[model samples]
Target: MGIKESDIKQDAACTPGLSNFFLKDHPDENKWADCVHCGMCLESCPTYELTSQEQHSPRGRVHLIKSVAEGKITVNEQFMDPVFACLDCRACTTACPAGVDVGGLIEEARGQIRQAIPLTGLKGMVSKFFLKGLFPHQNRLNSLGSILRFYQKSGMQKVVRKTKLIKIMPQHLVDMEAIMPEVNKPVRKKYKNQNVIKSKGKTRNEVSFLTGCVMDVMFSDINEATINVLTRNGNDVIIPNKQTCCGALHVHAGDRETGRKLAKQNIEAFNDSDKVIVNAAGCGYALKEYPELFREDPEWHEKAEKFAAKVEDISKYLYDTGYEKPKTELNTRITYHDACHLAHGQGVRQEPRDILLDIPGVEMVHMPNSDRCCGSAGIYNITNPEMASAVLDSKMENVPEDVDMISMGNPGCMLQMAMGVQKHGRNQKIVHTIQLLDWAYQKEDGKEGL
Candidate 1:
């Protein structure tokens, strides 16, 4: 369902948090005031570049947040329209030399609005039905992913793409319909409860794994490979079943209560573990950020800090472990797309690249502006198709010709990049970094292993 201006504008009494959506959490008196409005982000903003509309630009959105925060305006349906229009791509941040965290500011503002205004119509219906209903519940997401896999496997996707039937559907639906990946596995065969994939030699590290929601559903194999690679290199892998959603989708969407609830759950789950490992960049960024989410809760704030301290990106952990390079080299030409969370969010710029470099027979071509987002930010592609496609197009333009593969750490990015490749009528395989390692180690035909 789409959010109607009428529904948002009704003179409904606003809750404290709901009345002003951009004020409370993560409040930085100076940080909020740092937007100099230099307009430097305008050129780099995907939405602004695509639409050339002031309402869609970063500066415009920031102005809206400021206005809403100062009570200069009531955040009725039309008032929040610009805020909702933001993709949270973080491209604006990348472009902002002042280093204002637009992503965080916009997210907090959205949360405030969600609290104050009751979502109605199409947008509200979808959020309640999907995010609150389907995603948070792992089992349901698994089922939905399975159903989607069938569509991909049964060539329903191909039929839809060929007929362009979804073009008649909602724009968001058409985009989601266009950007599905080739699902290979339904579940990670191992890595379940008490199932430890121990390292071969003396274990150098003991780590807990977050077998993510969408990850467990759609691309379980990658998670499994991550486990195998970790163990083969001599590290004990632990999958803590208690770890729930990293509260990324929830937090990003402005559903803070549920996000905080899940945040507390994940924090307690990882508290006992020495090091918490996450394969998904988005999840990694969120998992390491529990402290900021629960800052207001004096009770859980300390726990949040401790949990945040132990979180590590899977690539960073693997790189630090000195995993030996696979000896057999396939001589494949590949490029890397840095997930925004891993790069800009955590300053994890080198670890993933270093891991890719360590692999044998892999020619790593550094794409121009590799650090820029591919525009698959969680729900951004679904909500903002035109800008997402614009960013994808910009991303694909940087891909070196003759590249056989493009690898990334985030699933959202992989799907978005794959869609970009398809739309351009080109054939380029997209895989996780671990996929390359997994295939390298397999003893099957034409197998390449150290």
Candidate 2:
């Protein structure tokens, strides 16, 4: 049966005073038009695969977003539903022969939603608080991180997990809630260099780490590990004080003004660095996309391009930086979960895998659709919990069984994958790529690298 014409929702769009569709400085229309719409993407779509909904399919959403972008379709709740529903996993792109860059389109759709309509619901508001509270400020997020850590250390988190509170919530909500690891220590000082010694020669490379909001507050150890790996590999790592939130949550949530400001801040903050080493795949992806985000302003556009050029997913950076094959053999089998941002947004295909393969004792097995999202797209898991969980459920089944550990590129994926491990009552561990790398570098016995 064909999609019913009456089922489509249409409404007058609220185009924010800036509507230059052909701005080259803005989003790339060439990338947007690359979708040939073959049904191959549907098979890998978790949302489509989960419910078999046509609207959830990558091809289906592409047409809608394309329609809205060209002003061919009215912007309304109907259009936004499918746009927001996307996990932005880039699994579809992985399967796309054309390399359509669906993740970029999804982000454009999100920018449209932010400007066109007021997406207000309880869920949307909670997302608002997360953007307002959890992101923008490093200080408050650290405090929250400390509290979560206290809850974990105090056994409250364990007790809560044991209880049915999450189950009482929506399935998706429970699924998202199920994924957060009890918090560890927060990163207190912004510029604390541990035991890493910089190479004495003309510096192999220089990079400034954007200790992103969630990265600073929640999974800080990953930051430490990133610093260790980069410096140990003979690069001078800088954690710039001027860096704030990467504005990923802002851009997705429709707050373009704040998003723009944050983009400019980051660009100027790390203006001097040759490479902006972003350990978190999501942040790296979003940071690189800022050129599109600020296409409207020439000055910012120039800066955004400059900034975007410098941005590097740490895994890709390390691989490009000449990481020698591991000296210590880690006699373990493992799986690598590619974050959507890294795989789809940045076109980072083999670098992370190549890095993992270089670990001598470690055998990195590719999970089916390793590029599929783990269902934690910024606040997507928290706000649209049900759909996120459904996507996560797909990931759970796709992972290989009996893996010693799982490595992922982003903090959100790491936490979500760890949660998935616990949900299945399995003993597998989760670690950032850098953490395991650092461990393997220092550990005499390979077991501890995880």
Identify the candidate with maximal TM-score: 1
Q: Alpha carbon lDDT of residue 150, candidate 2?
A: 84
Best by lDDT: 1
Would you list the C-alpha lDDT of every candidate in the order shown? 0.75, 0.74
Tens-digit lDDT track for model 1 on 7-64?
Answer: 4443322434233333356233344578889999998776777789887888888777
State the TM-score for model 2: 0.85
**How well does model 1 score by local distance difference test?**
0.75
Each prediction's TM-score versus the true structure: 0.87, 0.85
Off by over 4 Å in 1: 1-28, 94-97, 146-179, 182-189, 193-195, 443-450
Question: Backbone clashes per model, in order?
Answer: 10, 6
User: Candidate 2 residues 60-164, lDDT tens each?
Assistant: 988876675565665567877887888777778878888787777777766656655655698667767777766788778878887877877898867887886
